[model samples]
Target chain A: DVKVTQSSRYLVKRTGEKVFLECVQDMDHENMFWYRQDPGLGLRLIYFSYDVKMKEKGDIPEGYSVSREKKERFSLILESASTNQTSMYLCASRTGGVETQYFGPGTRLLVL
Target chain B: AQSVTQPDIHITVSEGASLELRCNYSYGATPYLFWYVQSPGQGLQLLLKYFSGDTLVQGIKGFEAEFKRSQSSFNLRKPSVHWSDAAEYFCAVNGGATNKLIFGTGTLLAVQP
Candidate 1:
Protein backbone atom coordinates (compact mmCIF):
# COMPACT_ATOMS: atom_id res chain seq x y z
CA ASP A 1 0.00 0.00 0.00
CA VAL A 2 1.23 3.48 -0.81
CA LYS A 3 1.25 5.56 2.35
CA VAL A 4 1.58 9.31 2.28
CA THR A 5 1.88 11.04 5.64
CA GLN A 6 1.71 14.69 6.60
CA SER A 7 3.54 16.17 9.55
CA SER A 8 0.56 17.81 11.16
CA ARG A 9 -3.19 17.35 10.91
CA TYR A 10 -4.08 20.80 12.26
CA LEU A 11 -2.07 23.93 12.90
CA VAL A 12 -2.66 27.47 14.12
CA LYS A 13 -0.33 30.38 13.48
CA ARG A 14 -0.40 34.13 13.83
CA THR A 15 -0.28 36.46 10.88
CA GLY A 16 3.14 37.03 9.26
CA GLU A 17 4.48 33.90 10.81
CA LYS A 18 6.30 31.42 8.67
CA VAL A 19 4.67 28.01 8.36
CA PHE A 20 5.94 24.68 7.27
CA LEU A 21 3.82 21.73 6.15
CA GLU A 22 5.67 18.51 5.60
CA CYS A 23 4.72 15.46 3.55
CA VAL A 24 6.33 12.05 3.19
CA GLN A 25 5.58 9.06 1.03
CA ASP A 26 6.65 5.46 1.44
CA MET A 27 5.98 4.23 -2.09
CA ASP A 28 9.25 5.60 -3.53
CA HIS A 29 7.25 7.58 -6.10
CA GLU A 30 9.08 10.15 -8.20
CA ASN A 31 6.35 12.79 -8.18
CA MET A 32 5.09 14.78 -5.20
CA PHE A 33 2.53 17.57 -5.04
CA TRP A 34 1.08 20.14 -2.68
CA TYR A 35 -2.45 21.45 -2.95
CA ARG A 36 -4.69 23.78 -1.03
CA GLN A 37 -8.39 22.93 -0.88
CA ASP A 38 -11.18 25.40 -0.31
CA PRO A 39 -14.96 25.22 -0.36
CA GLY A 40 -16.67 25.69 -3.75
CA LEU A 41 -13.24 26.24 -5.34
CA GLY A 42 -12.01 22.69 -4.78
CA LEU A 43 -8.33 21.76 -4.63
CA ARG A 44 -5.87 24.04 -6.37
CA LEU A 45 -2.33 23.04 -7.05
CA ILE A 46 0.31 24.93 -5.11
CA TYR A 47 3.60 23.29 -6.06
CA PHE A 48 4.97 20.00 -7.30
CA SER A 49 8.33 18.25 -7.34
CA TYR A 50 9.34 15.82 -10.04
CA ASP A 51 12.69 14.90 -8.57
CA VAL A 52 15.00 15.84 -5.75
CA LYS A 53 15.83 19.57 -5.83
CA MET A 54 13.47 20.11 -8.79
CA LYS A 55 10.25 22.06 -8.14
CA GLU A 56 7.56 23.61 -10.29
CA LYS A 57 4.88 26.13 -9.43
CA GLY A 58 1.25 25.27 -9.90
CA ASP A 59 -1.83 27.45 -10.28
CA ILE A 60 -1.49 29.36 -6.99
CA PRO A 61 2.09 29.72 -5.82
CA GLU A 62 2.20 33.16 -4.29
CA GLY A 63 3.61 33.38 -0.74
CA TYR A 64 4.45 29.67 -0.91
CA SER A 65 7.52 27.63 -1.80
CA VAL A 66 8.54 23.98 -1.74
CA SER A 67 11.54 21.81 -0.89
CA ARG A 68 12.43 18.33 -2.07
CA GLU A 69 15.79 17.54 -0.51
CA LYS A 70 15.08 13.82 -0.61
CA LYS A 71 12.99 11.53 -2.75
CA GLU A 72 10.65 10.47 0.06
CA ARG A 73 9.95 13.88 1.56
CA PHE A 74 8.44 17.08 0.19
CA SER A 75 7.94 20.23 2.21
CA LEU A 76 5.76 23.29 1.66
CA ILE A 77 6.84 26.58 3.15
CA LEU A 78 4.87 29.75 3.62
CA GLU A 79 7.17 32.75 3.66
CA SER A 80 4.66 34.92 5.46
CA ALA A 81 1.45 33.33 6.55
CA SER A 82 -1.72 35.36 6.10
CA THR A 83 -5.36 34.73 6.86
CA ASN A 84 -6.02 33.92 3.22
CA GLN A 85 -3.44 31.16 3.42
CA THR A 86 -5.59 29.26 5.89
CA SER A 87 -6.74 26.15 4.06
CA MET A 88 -6.74 22.40 4.04
CA TYR A 89 -3.39 21.41 2.58
CA LEU A 90 -3.02 18.07 0.88
CA CYS A 91 0.02 16.10 -0.26
CA ALA A 92 0.08 13.51 -2.99
CA SER A 93 2.63 11.21 -4.60
CA ARG A 94 2.53 9.27 -7.84
CA THR A 95 4.80 7.22 -10.03
CA GLY A 96 6.34 8.93 -13.07
CA GLY A 97 4.14 7.36 -15.76
CA VAL A 98 0.96 6.64 -13.79
CA GLU A 99 -1.67 9.31 -13.37
CA THR A 100 -3.17 7.77 -10.26
CA GLN A 101 -1.99 9.60 -7.12
CA TYR A 102 -2.13 8.61 -3.47
CA PHE A 103 -2.88 11.28 -0.90
CA GLY A 104 -2.09 11.80 2.74
CA PRO A 105 -4.33 13.01 5.53
CA GLY A 106 -4.55 16.76 5.01
CA THR A 107 -3.18 19.51 7.24
CA ARG A 108 -5.78 22.12 8.11
CA LEU A 109 -3.92 25.39 8.66
CA LEU A 110 -5.45 28.35 10.44
CA VAL A 111 -3.68 31.67 10.10
CA LEU A 112 -5.20 34.07 12.58
CA ALA B 1 -6.60 24.23 -21.89
CA GLN B 2 -8.17 21.16 -20.29
CA SER B 3 -10.86 21.62 -17.69
CA VAL B 4 -13.34 19.60 -15.62
CA THR B 5 -16.87 20.46 -14.58
CA GLN B 6 -19.08 18.74 -12.03
CA PRO B 7 -22.46 20.35 -12.65
CA ASP B 8 -24.29 19.34 -9.51
CA ILE B 9 -22.94 21.27 -6.54
CA HIS B 10 -24.84 19.32 -3.94
CA ILE B 11 -26.91 16.11 -3.98
CA THR B 12 -29.03 14.42 -1.31
CA VAL B 13 -30.05 10.78 -1.53
CA SER B 14 -31.82 8.39 0.78
CA GLU B 15 -30.00 5.45 2.30
CA GLY B 16 -30.13 2.23 0.25
CA ALA B 17 -31.09 4.21 -2.84
CA SER B 18 -29.23 4.17 -6.09
CA LEU B 19 -26.68 6.94 -6.66
CA GLU B 20 -25.11 8.76 -9.57
CA LEU B 21 -22.85 11.84 -9.79
CA ARG B 22 -22.20 13.60 -13.06
CA CYS B 23 -18.84 14.78 -14.42
CA ASN B 24 -18.00 16.45 -17.71
CA TYR B 25 -14.68 17.50 -19.19
CA SER B 26 -13.38 19.67 -22.02
CA TYR B 27 -10.12 18.62 -23.60
CA GLY B 28 -8.51 18.67 -27.03
CA ALA B 29 -7.38 15.05 -27.09
CA THR B 30 -8.05 11.79 -25.30
CA PRO B 31 -7.58 12.62 -21.61
CA TYR B 32 -7.07 10.70 -18.44
CA LEU B 33 -10.14 10.79 -16.18
CA PHE B 34 -10.41 10.08 -12.46
CA TRP B 35 -12.91 10.14 -9.61
CA TYR B 36 -11.91 10.94 -6.04
CA VAL B 37 -13.77 11.04 -2.73
CA GLN B 38 -12.88 13.19 0.29
CA SER B 39 -14.39 12.57 3.67
CA PRO B 40 -14.85 15.36 6.17
CA GLY B 41 -11.45 16.52 7.44
CA GLN B 42 -9.71 13.90 5.33
CA GLY B 43 -7.52 13.87 2.27
CA LEU B 44 -8.82 12.93 -1.16
CA GLN B 45 -8.94 9.24 -2.01
CA LEU B 46 -8.90 7.78 -5.48
CA LEU B 47 -12.19 6.08 -6.34
CA LEU B 48 -11.56 5.10 -9.94
CA LYS B 49 -9.67 6.05 -13.07
CA TYR B 50 -10.26 5.86 -16.85
CA PHE B 51 -7.11 5.80 -19.00
CA SER B 52 -8.04 3.57 -21.92
CA GLY B 53 -10.17 0.58 -22.72
CA ASP B 54 -13.04 -0.39 -20.39
CA THR B 55 -15.29 2.62 -20.21
CA LEU B 56 -17.02 1.10 -17.21
CA VAL B 57 -14.53 1.10 -14.34
CA GLN B 58 -15.13 -0.26 -10.86
CA GLY B 59 -13.64 1.20 -7.71
CA ILE B 60 -13.55 0.70 -4.00
CA LYS B 61 -16.60 0.81 -1.71
CA GLY B 62 -18.91 -0.56 -4.39
CA PHE B 63 -18.45 2.49 -6.57
CA GLU B 64 -18.44 2.38 -10.38
CA ALA B 65 -18.19 4.91 -13.18
CA GLU B 66 -18.64 4.87 -16.93
CA PHE B 67 -16.78 6.98 -19.45
CA LYS B 68 -18.69 8.15 -22.52
CA ARG B 69 -16.47 9.59 -25.19
CA SER B 70 -19.38 10.95 -27.22
CA GLN B 71 -20.69 13.06 -24.34
CA SER B 72 -17.29 13.64 -22.73
CA SER B 73 -18.72 12.48 -19.44
CA PHE B 74 -17.69 10.17 -16.64
CA ASN B 75 -20.50 9.60 -14.19
CA LEU B 76 -20.10 7.67 -10.95
CA ARG B 77 -22.85 5.31 -9.79
CA LYS B 78 -23.58 2.94 -6.97
CA PRO B 79 -26.30 0.31 -6.70
CA SER B 80 -26.96 1.02 -3.04
CA VAL B 81 -25.93 3.87 -0.82
CA HIS B 82 -24.78 3.85 2.78
CA TRP B 83 -24.72 6.68 5.25
CA SER B 84 -20.96 6.57 5.43
CA ASP B 85 -20.85 7.28 1.70
CA ALA B 86 -21.69 10.90 2.35
CA ALA B 87 -18.73 13.06 1.35
CA GLU B 88 -17.34 15.45 -1.24
CA TYR B 89 -16.70 13.89 -4.67
CA PHE B 90 -14.40 15.43 -7.25
CA CYS B 91 -13.79 14.80 -10.94
CA ALA B 92 -10.27 15.32 -12.26
CA VAL B 93 -8.46 15.17 -15.59
CA ASN B 94 -4.82 15.15 -16.58
CA GLY B 95 -3.91 18.66 -17.72
CA GLY B 96 -1.38 17.44 -20.33
CA ALA B 97 2.25 16.41 -20.59
CA THR B 98 2.94 18.23 -17.34
CA ASN B 99 1.13 15.36 -15.61
CA LYS B 100 -0.88 17.76 -13.48
CA LEU B 101 -4.58 17.30 -12.78
CA ILE B 102 -7.36 19.82 -13.19
CA PHE B 103 -10.21 19.24 -10.76
CA GLY B 104 -13.84 20.21 -10.66
CA THR B 105 -15.50 22.23 -7.93
CA GLY B 106 -16.75 19.03 -6.36
CA THR B 107 -20.22 17.84 -5.31
CA LEU B 108 -21.21 17.40 -1.71
CA LEU B 109 -23.28 14.27 -1.06
CA ALA B 110 -25.76 14.04 1.79
CA VAL B 111 -27.29 10.68 2.67
CA GLN B 112 -30.66 10.80 4.35
CA PRO B 113 -31.91 8.21 6.75
Candidate 2:
Protein backbone atom coordinates (compact mmCIF):
# COMPACT_ATOMS: atom_id res chain seq x y z
CA ASP A 1 0.00 0.00 0.00
CA VAL A 2 1.15 3.53 -0.75
CA LYS A 3 1.60 5.88 2.15
CA VAL A 4 1.47 9.64 1.98
CA THR A 5 2.45 11.40 5.17
CA GLN A 6 1.95 15.03 6.05
CA SER A 7 4.13 17.01 8.45
CA SER A 8 1.42 18.52 10.63
CA ARG A 9 -2.05 17.37 11.42
CA TYR A 10 -3.13 20.71 12.84
CA LEU A 11 -1.64 24.18 12.91
CA VAL A 12 -2.54 27.67 14.09
CA LYS A 13 -0.88 30.86 12.97
CA ARG A 14 -1.44 34.56 13.26
CA THR A 15 -2.17 36.81 10.32
CA GLY A 16 0.86 37.85 8.20
CA GLU A 17 2.83 34.79 9.33
CA LYS A 18 4.48 32.48 6.88
CA VAL A 19 3.55 28.78 6.99
CA PHE A 20 5.00 25.68 5.49
CA LEU A 21 3.19 22.36 5.03
CA GLU A 22 5.18 19.34 4.06
CA CYS A 23 4.17 16.08 2.39
CA VAL A 24 6.08 12.91 1.70
CA GLN A 25 5.00 9.95 -0.37
CA ASP A 26 6.57 6.51 -0.21
CA MET A 27 5.38 5.37 -3.62
CA ASP A 28 7.93 7.34 -5.64
CA HIS A 29 5.20 8.96 -7.64
CA GLU A 30 6.14 11.48 -10.29
CA ASN A 31 3.43 14.00 -9.58
CA MET A 32 2.33 15.71 -6.38
CA PHE A 33 -0.49 18.15 -5.73
CA TRP A 34 -1.58 20.61 -3.05
CA TYR A 35 -5.15 21.65 -2.49
CA ARG A 36 -7.20 23.68 -0.07
CA GLN A 37 -10.63 22.40 0.82
CA ASP A 38 -13.32 24.84 1.92
CA PRO A 39 -16.93 24.37 2.84
CA GLY A 40 -19.24 24.08 -0.21
CA LEU A 41 -16.41 24.87 -2.63
CA GLY A 42 -14.83 21.40 -2.35
CA LEU A 43 -11.17 20.71 -3.10
CA ARG A 44 -9.53 23.49 -5.10
CA LEU A 45 -6.05 22.85 -6.39
CA ILE A 46 -3.30 25.18 -5.17
CA TYR A 47 -0.22 23.88 -6.97
CA PHE A 48 1.19 20.73 -8.54
CA SER A 49 4.69 19.58 -9.33
CA TYR A 50 5.61 17.04 -11.95
CA ASP A 51 9.24 16.71 -11.02
CA VAL A 52 11.82 18.06 -8.67
CA LYS A 53 12.06 21.86 -8.91
CA MET A 54 9.15 22.02 -11.34
CA LYS A 55 5.78 23.45 -10.31
CA GLU A 56 2.58 24.61 -11.93
CA LYS A 57 -0.09 26.89 -10.58
CA GLY A 58 -3.50 25.37 -10.08
CA ASP A 59 -6.86 27.08 -10.11
CA ILE A 60 -6.30 28.87 -6.81
CA PRO A 61 -2.62 29.75 -6.38
CA GLU A 62 -2.69 33.29 -5.06
CA GLY A 63 -0.72 33.79 -1.82
CA TYR A 64 0.55 30.23 -2.05
CA SER A 65 3.60 28.55 -3.57
CA VAL A 66 5.09 25.07 -3.58
CA SER A 67 8.45 23.34 -3.72
CA ARG A 68 9.52 19.89 -4.79
CA GLU A 69 13.13 19.68 -3.69
CA LYS A 70 13.24 15.89 -3.73
CA LYS A 71 11.29 13.12 -5.42
CA GLU A 72 9.57 12.02 -2.22
CA ARG A 73 8.94 15.39 -0.65
CA PHE A 74 6.69 18.30 -1.62
CA SER A 75 6.11 21.45 0.36
CA LEU A 76 3.41 24.10 0.31
CA ILE A 77 4.26 27.59 1.48
CA LEU A 78 1.90 30.30 2.50
CA GLU A 79 3.79 33.55 1.93
CA SER A 80 1.58 35.65 4.17
CA ALA A 81 -1.07 33.80 6.05
CA SER A 82 -4.44 35.49 6.28
CA THR A 83 -7.66 34.61 8.02
CA ASN A 84 -9.11 33.56 4.71
CA GLN A 85 -6.34 31.00 4.27
CA THR A 86 -7.70 28.97 7.16
CA SER A 87 -8.82 25.67 5.69
CA MET A 88 -8.04 21.99 5.33
CA TYR A 89 -4.98 21.32 3.20
CA LEU A 90 -4.53 18.08 1.31
CA CYS A 91 -1.58 16.55 -0.49
CA ALA A 92 -1.88 13.93 -3.19
CA SER A 93 0.60 11.99 -5.31
CA ARG A 94 0.27 9.96 -8.48
CA THR A 95 2.49 8.16 -10.94
CA GLY A 96 2.93 9.59 -14.38
CA GLY A 97 0.27 8.53 -16.95
CA VAL A 98 -1.96 7.32 -14.15
CA GLU A 99 -4.93 9.39 -13.08
CA THR A 100 -5.39 7.77 -9.69
CA GLN A 101 -4.11 9.92 -6.84
CA TYR A 102 -3.16 8.73 -3.37
CA PHE A 103 -3.70 11.40 -0.72
CA GLY A 104 -2.08 12.08 2.59
CA PRO A 105 -3.86 12.80 5.82
CA GLY A 106 -4.79 16.46 5.58
CA THR A 107 -3.42 19.38 7.57
CA ARG A 108 -6.02 21.56 9.20
CA LEU A 109 -4.72 25.14 9.27
CA LEU A 110 -6.21 27.96 11.27
CA VAL A 111 -5.12 31.56 10.77
CA LEU A 112 -6.24 34.08 13.30
CA ALA B 1 -12.93 23.05 -20.30
CA GLN B 2 -13.86 20.07 -18.13
CA SER B 3 -16.05 20.40 -15.06
CA VAL B 4 -17.92 18.18 -12.61
CA THR B 5 -21.09 18.69 -10.59
CA GLN B 6 -22.51 16.76 -7.68
CA PRO B 7 -26.09 17.91 -7.20
CA ASP B 8 -26.91 16.77 -3.68
CA ILE B 9 -25.16 18.63 -0.92
CA HIS B 10 -26.18 16.15 1.77
CA ILE B 11 -27.92 12.75 1.83
CA THR B 12 -29.15 10.57 4.68
CA VAL B 13 -29.83 6.85 4.47
CA SER B 14 -30.57 4.03 6.87
CA GLU B 15 -28.19 1.18 7.44
CA GLY B 16 -28.81 -1.74 5.05
CA ALA B 17 -30.49 0.59 2.59
CA SER B 18 -29.25 1.03 -0.94
CA LEU B 19 -27.26 4.15 -1.73
CA GLU B 20 -26.60 6.32 -4.73
CA LEU B 21 -24.69 9.59 -5.12
CA ARG B 22 -25.16 11.58 -8.28
CA CYS B 23 -22.35 13.09 -10.35
CA ASN B 24 -22.50 14.99 -13.64
CA TYR B 25 -19.74 16.27 -15.86
CA SER B 26 -19.23 18.57 -18.81
CA TYR B 27 -16.51 17.65 -21.29
CA GLY B 28 -16.18 17.65 -25.05
CA ALA B 29 -14.69 14.17 -25.44
CA THR B 30 -14.04 11.01 -23.49
CA PRO B 31 -13.16 12.11 -19.96
CA TYR B 32 -11.51 10.27 -17.12
CA LEU B 33 -14.00 10.01 -14.25
CA PHE B 34 -13.31 9.47 -10.58
CA TRP B 35 -15.15 9.28 -7.28
CA TYR B 36 -13.44 9.91 -3.96
CA VAL B 37 -14.60 9.70 -0.35
CA GLN B 38 -13.27 11.71 2.55
CA SER B 39 -13.89 10.66 6.09
CA PRO B 40 -14.38 13.35 8.70
CA GLY B 41 -11.20 15.46 8.92
CA GLN B 42 -9.33 13.14 6.57
CA GLY B 43 -7.93 13.28 3.08
CA LEU B 44 -9.76 11.99 0.03
CA GLN B 45 -9.67 8.29 -0.90
CA LEU B 46 -10.31 6.92 -4.32
CA LEU B 47 -13.60 5.08 -4.54
CA LEU B 48 -13.51 4.23 -8.22
CA LYS B 49 -12.46 5.42 -11.68
CA TYR B 50 -13.74 5.07 -15.21
CA PHE B 51 -11.66 5.59 -18.32
CA SER B 52 -13.23 3.30 -20.88
CA GLY B 53 -14.30 -0.28 -21.63
CA ASP B 54 -16.92 -1.20 -19.04
CA THR B 55 -19.34 1.50 -18.04
CA LEU B 56 -19.67 0.12 -14.53
CA VAL B 57 -16.64 -0.03 -12.25
CA GLN B 58 -16.31 -1.54 -8.79
CA GLY B 59 -14.40 0.26 -6.09
CA ILE B 60 -13.07 -0.23 -2.60
CA LYS B 61 -15.28 -0.63 0.47
CA GLY B 62 -18.17 -2.08 -1.46
CA PHE B 63 -18.67 1.02 -3.58
CA GLU B 64 -19.37 1.02 -7.31
CA ALA B 65 -20.09 3.64 -9.95
CA GLU B 66 -21.69 3.51 -13.38
CA PHE B 67 -20.84 5.74 -16.27
CA LYS B 68 -23.48 6.97 -18.68
CA ARG B 69 -21.99 8.76 -21.59
CA SER B 70 -25.29 9.91 -23.03
CA GLN B 71 -26.33 11.61 -19.82
CA SER B 72 -22.77 12.61 -18.96
CA SER B 73 -23.31 11.11 -15.55
CA PHE B 74 -21.18 8.83 -13.39
CA ASN B 75 -23.17 8.05 -10.29
CA LEU B 76 -21.89 6.05 -7.33
CA ARG B 77 -23.95 3.27 -5.75
CA LYS B 78 -23.73 0.62 -3.10
CA PRO B 79 -25.93 -2.39 -2.42
CA SER B 80 -26.02 -1.89 1.33
CA VAL B 81 -25.14 1.08 3.43
CA HIS B 82 -23.12 1.00 6.62
CA TRP B 83 -22.40 3.50 9.36
CA SER B 84 -18.80 3.65 8.20
CA ASP B 85 -19.92 4.77 4.78
CA ALA B 86 -21.00 8.13 6.08
CA ALA B 87 -18.60 10.65 4.64
CA GLU B 88 -18.19 13.41 2.09
CA TYR B 89 -17.95 12.23 -1.52
CA PHE B 90 -16.42 14.16 -4.36
CA CYS B 91 -16.62 13.67 -8.12
CA ALA B 92 -13.83 14.65 -10.48
CA VAL B 93 -13.12 14.64 -14.19
CA ASN B 94 -10.02 15.10 -16.33
CA GLY B 95 -10.19 15.75 -20.01
CA GLY B 96 -7.27 14.09 -21.79
CA ALA B 97 -5.25 17.22 -22.44
CA THR B 98 -4.63 19.11 -19.21
CA ASN B 99 -3.61 16.39 -16.70
CA LYS B 100 -5.44 18.45 -14.09
CA LEU B 101 -8.62 17.28 -12.45
CA ILE B 102 -11.70 19.44 -12.00
CA PHE B 103 -13.58 18.55 -8.85
CA GLY B 104 -17.21 19.01 -7.93
CA THR B 105 -18.49 20.42 -4.68
CA GLY B 106 -18.83 17.29 -2.57
CA THR B 107 -21.92 15.47 -1.31
CA LEU B 108 -22.00 14.52 2.34
CA LEU B 109 -23.53 11.13 3.15
CA ALA B 110 -24.96 10.23 6.53
CA VAL B 111 -25.96 6.74 7.57
CA GLN B 112 -28.46 6.22 10.37
CA PRO B 113 -28.71 2.98 12.23
Candidate closest to the true structure, highest DockQ: 2
Off by over 4 Å in 2: none
Residue pairs clashing in model 2 are none
Candidate 1 lDDT by residue in tens digits, B1-113? 88999999999999999999999999988889999999999999999999999899999999999999999999999999999999999999985789799999999999999
* Per-prediction TM-score, chain B alone: 0.98, 0.97
In CAPRI terms, where does candidate 1 land?
Answer: medium
Clashing pairs in 1: none
Q: What is the TM-score of chain A in candidate 1?
A: 0.98
lDDT of 1 at B29: 88
Q: Model 1, range A2-111, lDDT digits (tens) per residue?
A: 99999999999999998999999999899999999999998899999999999999999999999999999999999999999989999999998646989999999999
lDDT of candidates 1 onward, in order = 0.95, 0.94
Q: After superposition, how far is residue B1 of candidate 2 from its true place, in Å?
A: 1.5
**TM-score, cand. 2:** 0.98
The candidates' interface RMSDs, in order, read: 1.3, 1.1
TM-score to true structure, per model? 0.98, 0.98
